[model samples]
Target: MEYEILGLPAWYYIAMVAKVLVVFVWVLLTVAYATYAERKIIGHMQVRLGPMRTGWHGLLQPIADGLKLFFKEEIIPAEASTFAFLVAPLIALVPAFISFAVIPFGTTITVMGCKIPLQIAAYADKSGGVIDVNVGVLYILALSSLGVYGIVLAGWSSNSKYSLLGGLRASAQMISYELAAGLALITVFMVSGTLSLQQIVADQAGFGWYAWRNPFLFGAFIIFFICSLAEINRTPFDLPEAETELVSGFCTEYSSMKYAMFFMAEYANMITVCAITVTLFLGGWHGPFTDAFPLLSPLYFIAKVYSLIFLCMWIRATYPRYRYDQLMGLGWKFFLPITLVLIVGNGLWISVIGAGNWLGSLFA
Candidate 1:
């Protein structure tokens, strides 16, 4: 039983576990504040004050929310597949968190005489391997896409019509948007000449982000952002749980912790998409002159990611819900075609310009 983490001694297993624990805690805390940030931003958008009572402009609102959900009566439907119902949320959430393990957060640094890459466990000789997978973008897409299963299962296992319909809607919504998202990501890979997220970030090291690469990338960014909203089931694209129509959608019959699991999964997915956007398009932990002053890189990366998250919250607060058909039409008729053409155009443009070599040199 000699399990090692990143080729380190087996004793580092405890440190790996501790590392994951810390990330879990961070995700929980981030989700809590994301709710708060959404409220405050939306409140201001609607010309009203946001949560200000709990703790200094409502910092403790998430805590209040946790207490509320905790004390709420637990309800399990008599006809539900009780075991599957209970398992769905965990299935949905764990993968969302685990995918982050492969995403490199920052450059390697010497900490306490140990070299550390701001990433979690990677396979030994991580270069171009599963741990530091060259197909990171695809891996993220695959993992995030799998999240739909948990929702679908929860809805089916609930044995309720509303829940079932909600699940179906979610399945369709995620599937459609994932197509556009995949195409958009392909455009990034085309322009950057790599599928590895770390390499993508590395590519953006000197030159500005892919978002600044050109107007085409801006279009891709728009498509990616919109698709992410649908993928994460956020407002405007939140037809699955449209309170007026579906009565809380798939989790209508879910209660207590089950409901909380769905809630947590939503936020976790949000973070995942945000992280993906940062890594793929905005440049993961790269910054100006980072090779000279490496410390600022991670800060810049965090700033960009949080800013993107803030923008998501802003959109949630400002926009009204879309009609279900409108959501689908946007994905199919509009984003899909545009992304397809853009990806093709990107490939053509890259070929003409010699596969990012010219761009890289010019930027360098």
Candidate 2:
């Protein structure tokens, strides 16, 4: 049997390992700081100082928080299932981190007369990302759907009424919103004619970004954003963790680093959703000078993601939490119908004008 990848020597595995390490470290750092950014931004929005004492305006607040959690006493409920309770956070957290594997962060760069992808993996000469699978969208959807299990298990295993209710609400909420979110993205797949996220980004290169190029997709983008908020349990849709009611919801029984894992998972999911949004609607890594200087692509991508994250924070500060019924209504009643209409309308429009041709027909 021959052992090779893309006809490269076995030593290539070493490079792949190094790339994975880099991405994992990068994502961890980003997730940590995203929490700090959220608190600071929301504090300022409410006319209050946020995290001012930790390190020069709380620059090192994430680090301090991490250390605090690390040293905290671990607690497990006497009545909880020993194993499932212990592993629930890992199940929740790992999926959020892995979802970023398929996201295209930047373009390829030439180094020493050889092309190197900014992401961990590449498909021959086509696209750069970590494992550019044919069903990239499906992969993400599957992993995201799996994240609900951790919450459900945590809630059920805890034997607490509040935790169980929180878990049930989370599962129902996520399932409802996932349908709308998937339907919203169907328009993008219909137009792009492929499930590969990197290809979707490639289709939007130059001035052909979907959000501006197709008017219908702008609606889809909005739908996606709303559903994403519900999916991530952000403010205005945070029924599962309603402090006034559920007492921290499904994680009521968790403490120490296990609790921190759930917290990190939430922020990590936020980062993943923001990155996916940038890739799908805002044109991942596409910007002025991106083509001329490939190194600038990542900068553009990260800036756009940060902007979206700030918007999420702003909404958190501005809006009160929705009642549970209202949250479910928004997903099932509003976003579902809207996304279905947009999907059908987009499909018909694409069928009429053809993929990547709508832009030219508008000016014609």
Candidate 3:
């Protein structure tokens, strides 16, 4: 017997396709401009000028950069594993795009009298969302863990010492810090009692639950943020690609679009992480007048996400790279232990008082 494909109507497919196109384009544009934002932000912080000639105030710099990379000659090393080398960039970039599938950008909107959620996975209603899954947090974590393999493959396939070392460093760093980051999010899971990101945002409808409503979670938030920095290989924890040491690390032999894909994956991951942070820590899509004006949800979400991204850039500009030993030590000794302790404390708090007691007005 043949299946009827979930018995869904044609309209559902059309609407889903529309949402996919919109989200994909938006994410791609955001990933491109994030590089520009970082350069400009750090430039101002360092009292120097960033790209100013590409367009008016460097507005088109990312576009120029993308085009330049697109048309560049593709080169493959003679001794490289041809298939894996080519596939690595795809592995790196695909996760960054697909992870957005589960992220909720805004609350429900009425389109043709049908309530549609801003999440790519499912439509949101009061009961929950209509997405493919209820566990968005886990979905993100899984996709994030998968992205590192591309780096490892790139390094290993290139058959270069620098690339191999970078891949090794990336694998180790991911294992070291991902634990603390995962544990830190336990605070959110415990308080929210669900792994659905959309639901987590719904629960944080106050002055941001992790920000003010629950003061204890703030510490874990910092730990989570630091761990995220390591996961994304940002400046201070960028040992995997430390230019001074590894000569471009995993992408040492990669050039043209392959090299570009690495950076694209990085920025896209940045956006994904910041979006997760907003959903779990900050009140997502909930700002002034959000109650009265549901249309403002996307704007609020975007504002909060960019604010977090800006904070990441600030940290990048201000902090110096940590020694490899110090990096491992911080992850293992400091962050891991602290996250465990915070989990225990949050468990106790939840058992005794409950989150709603902290800010009774926040629950949806």
TM-score of each predicted structure versus truth: 0.90, 0.93, 0.94
For residue 269, model 1's alpha carbon misses the true position, in angstroms, by 0.6
Q: Give residue 59's lDDT in candidate 2 (0 to 100).
A: 98
- Across 181-268, the per-residue lDDT of candidate 1 in tens digits comes to 8888887877777777766776776656787676678789888988999988998899999999999898899887778888888988
Number of the top candidate by TM-score?
3
lDDT of 2 by residue, 82-128 (tens): 89998899999999999877887888776544456666645344242
CA lDDT of 145 in candidate 2?
A: 94
Better of 1 and 3 by lDDT: 3
User: What is the number of residue pairs that collide in model 2?
Assistant: 0
TM-score for candidate 3: 0.94
lDDT per prediction? 0.80, 0.85, 0.86
The candidate, 2 or 3, that scores higher on TM-score is 3
Of candidate 1, the 10-residue stretch with the lowest lDDT total is 122-131
- What lDDT would candidate 3 get against the real structure? 0.86
Candidate 3: segments with Cα more than 4 A from true spot: 1-6, 124-132, 360-364
Which segments of candidate 2 are over 4 A away from where they belong?
Answer: 1-7, 125-131, 357-364
